[model samples]
Target: MGNKLNQGWLYTDRINAKVVGQTVLDFYSQRYGHSDRQVWQERIELGQIAVDGKTVNPSYPLQAGQTLTYWRSPWAEPDVPLTLPVLYQDEDLWAIDKPVGLPVLPGGDFVYHTVLEQLKIQFPQESLFPLHRLGTGTSGLLLLGRSALGRRELSRQFRENLCRKIYRTLIGPCSLSEQFDCHQAIGKIPYPQLGYIYAATADGKSAHSYGRILARSPEKPGWK
Candidate 1:
């Protein structure tokens, strides 16, 4: 229905059966009961939604049937993250602590605020492999695998590096020569997603990064 004070309707089993196929602040927080991510973050800032018509994704995955439209939002409300924090899970694996800006699933603009829909709302019954890839801001340890021999033993321990990785980077204001060696040839610049580190001239490809500068530096945010 026209103008922004708004109202429109449509859903397969015939209209007005109590808002079909869901949405429109999940039928206004289930007719005022809230929670469905509290009306999907209150209609995503009140622009009042639009699915088949476009502008969708407040987790957008509603389709055992389709159709959703909205235009209801009196004011502010956004920080609708109900939960996610499982430092470890069993039956074959599930680790967490991926904070820093979060994103271990759902690409680009970040669908449903990632970490695989918060581990599918905590193991919605299966499938959760995710071996490695932590750089959405880069925080710490994360490895998930749940059966199938724990995803083939953590995918053969991250493809044979035997997994004992330790990282703690944050360096600058260097004075060099503390046993230096970064003989490089890093690659990746195709479909896109950053990766570089040169100096193996005559076209590079085999990267190497082995260092040990345990401590040293003399400025602010310094080093130790």
Candidate 2:
């Protein structure tokens, strides 16, 4: 199979107060770290970086409230499953069976090879937005909003904790009770590779989950 490629993309960001005085090269190199300083300089020289709609040099100083736009060239993105099955649909909502290995939105190395872009191509006449998100490695039913009013209402439902969410997973053999409640707090922590990642910590936000054993495999000593 042939790999999918996006034509091009425009990445936009606003200069915040913390990094207002930094130059374009310093800002991009220190904050993003996706490209080396030399590559960023080359892109800047090629007019790929813009400030407030005007092309700027690498030494251009950024100011608070100014818009920064990066014209990213087209590139080959990682291949992923493109099939999206509709489990349910209504005038205001849609439930899609999202396959594993497919990213819910564009980020990192993925631009056009994303569920959001695919949905836009499939429903060109409609304005649809995901109500929530699922990880790239996760396969589950994803909910979407069909209209502005629908989005607002559904977002409120999630904020008020009215919607129920359940997840099933397979794990290695272990001893466990019939039912259990895990209250592990999760928050962002600095890492060596990525800037930061979410993990369990004492000073994190409260997170709770309830799990129950449905079945046990005698041969493998696994539970579900």
Candidate 3:
């Protein structure tokens, strides 16, 4: 699809005690590094940011329980496939074959070019929300919930480990092993570009994955 001009966006957040004394500029620049300090200052000066329903200077000190709102001007978003193939559908659930490169949610430089936005456009009358997420580069079946009761129950199942999720990936060739398991703890580490990102670490939360060899490619020297 061609690049689309979004109808702007209104983002709001509540100031918490952790950042109660931070300046408006510092809060945004430190927490959200999408824009630089100069860009944030420009937006604040243009009345794009407000606290408690009133525009404030960049140096304005934030207080706990205050509402901060930002009006992001409409801009052209990156082009992406806007098609979603329905694999299964029911009264309370839907399973879609999500295409690769389509973001499951809005983040980074994507806003209107996400699966959630396409869902809104295709099913305007229905209130469906994604129950799980797939990476932008992964193609897989995405499950969505159409009712609050269904969503709550499925969320509970996921939290309690009642659901089994299996993923297939291509990796460099290694010694043959019938089956393998990984117990690497994953946690966020500081990243200069995007604040923090998940990686395996000793003090991170427990994570496990099971892999079974499906096939091997002689030409590519990889296992799937």
Candidate 4:
């Protein structure tokens, strides 16, 4: 609302960092000596700010073990007319329902046309932290973290196999009950034959997939 004040403070060696925001009126009033702590009926909502590491309330009074960050936001950045649809949020993560065809980050040939640029334009003051990748053709939930602490917590979840993932695909089929597990050696196919690492094997990355017939269309007779 007003000039965004971005400041950081650390209360203790083991604590995390935090931020404060001001609405349009209070930002200008702070230039003078402690005139009055600008209060937002809401944004002044002080809280401990770390992604995965800790939890704190805005009025925690900044103990000796905490840190703070500030951004004196001047109000002139052009508004981004478009916005990202946020699906879920908490101290540790932002989950978004991504649309198909949008790449997750900046890269060759994309530059200003990417999701990172759009988000930066939308929330001009807060730094965005993106973790993980999704192909441009894929659409689903994307997870993001706000601070180093949060990143650590999410990384632990990834390492401990605590995350749940599921995917679906539509492919034409030929059998009524086409189900079988093909277990075999996936060594390189000799010379020209084409092949790939397949099924549940003792090597390669571990992944599991399951599929069943959902709907059969009258337009496709072989699907039965």
Candidate 5:
């Protein structure tokens, strides 16, 4: 794969009163060198413009002190290692331990280099449908439905919250007890430089998590 060159965000600070009531298209045209309004207009349609940490319309009102972010399209896709281990497989479904760095589906600069594409290649005979998605940063078990019946049943279970997942991870010393349940709301907030926002919020969808301190690290102040 060729080296990725086209990935990043362009930022601008709204310090002066020069752009108070101007539309995003008008402001970019005046402030930036690109005189073609159509270009900026197209980028806005592609979800490339954000104000303060949220994507909004091109005509969004800009307030002083708010930050503007623009996503720059990459020139090429970067290389990502694709290594998935099948934990269980049958006529109905396959449980796969997906490796980190492989996207579950096409997004950003990835298209063919994704878990979906890889599974299609490996299980040419089975028509696989992903049950859920995990971020590229996480390596975990992914359930894939193999047939129409399997897809419908698994999807129904997930929708009704009948499925439970246990995640094991290492974390720093905690104030939490040996066992505790955390109820936190999950939502989306603007990512620092990335084009899209990520899940994190003070108040959002209801979520419950149970954690237990399995073991404490002997050398460092950490727990598993």
Candidate 6:
């Protein structure tokens, strides 16, 4: 596949009772809301579906709670601009304002059109290392280490929680207090089209976010 962006076993889940006793083809046809059995059968013949990590025949009997995995074919991604504005730069570190919709690293149909790849072309002499990453849909400032020693120092700060970053976001009306702190555990879970999903989970690392209501909608009219 040409750049194979956002493609993988992006879709995976455990089969439940409703699908038990049915053929894999039948289960998928119902599970995906597609009634065409022939279409699913073709995918099965290609070994696109796996049960308990093993490829099986299309007519393989479904089992309750068996893990099902599917590798999605490559799909097109938006042609977002690769270069971003340089907010700050020095011999050791570079802070760049990354645009929304641009991926930080290569994934899902995006290889050469990523921030990492673009930076390499922008600064051919010094080795560039990413200190952190932002979601493809997010727009914000990103920090990068320009050299090996710079990379290590910045990486240690993040790993040890010594570095703090503040993000600005706009949301709907809320009745929340002016200031608040949320200490919730967050982690990544497999999702369908987006690769991995990040959210609060019981079995996750500790995460903290501080929210301060800047202004209400009408109160802060004309706000970007």
Q: Report the number of the highest-lDDT candidate.
A: 3
Off by over 4 Å in 3: 188-204, 221-224
What tens digits encode model 3's per-residue C-alpha lDDT throughout 1-224?
47667888888989999999999999999888767999999999999999999999999999999999999988887777789998988888888998887888876567678899889998899888998878677899898998888788888888898987889877765785879899999886765432345678888999998889998765555433
**For every model shown, what is its TM-score relative to the native structure?**
0.24, 0.86, 0.88, 0.44, 0.62, 0.62
Off by over 4 Å in 5: 2-74, 121-125, 192-198, 218-224
Residue 80, model 3, lDDT: 71
TM-score comparison, 1 vs 6, better candidate? 6
After TM-score superposition, what is the CA distance of residue 181 in candidate 5 from its true location, in Å? 1.3
Worst 10 residues of 6 by lDDT: 1-10
**How do all the candidates rank in terms of lDDT, highest first?**
3, 2, 6, 5, 1, 4
After superposing candidate 6, which stretches have Cα over 4 Å from the reference?
1-75, 218-224
Give lDDT tens digits, candidate 4, residues 1-224: 12332232222223223223422223323422222454321323443333124443334343333333332222222222223688887777777776665666643223333467666776676555666655555677877776677778877787786875555545554564544333343331212111121234455454544455666654545555
Q: How many clashes show up in model 5? A: 2
Candidate 5 per-residue lDDT, tens place, 1-224, comes to: 35756444365556357778777777776665433688888887788888876887778777777788877755565577776788998888889998877778765456556788778777787788789887777789999999788899999998998998777777765677899988887775543222233465886688888999988764554432
- The 0-to-1 C-alpha lDDT of every candidate, in the order given, reads 0.57, 0.83, 0.84, 0.47, 0.74, 0.78
lDDT of 5 at 79: 74
CA RMSD (A), model 4: 18.9
For residue 106, give model 1's deviation from the true position in Å: 25
Best by TM-score: 3
RMSD of 1: 18.6
lDDT of 1: 0.57
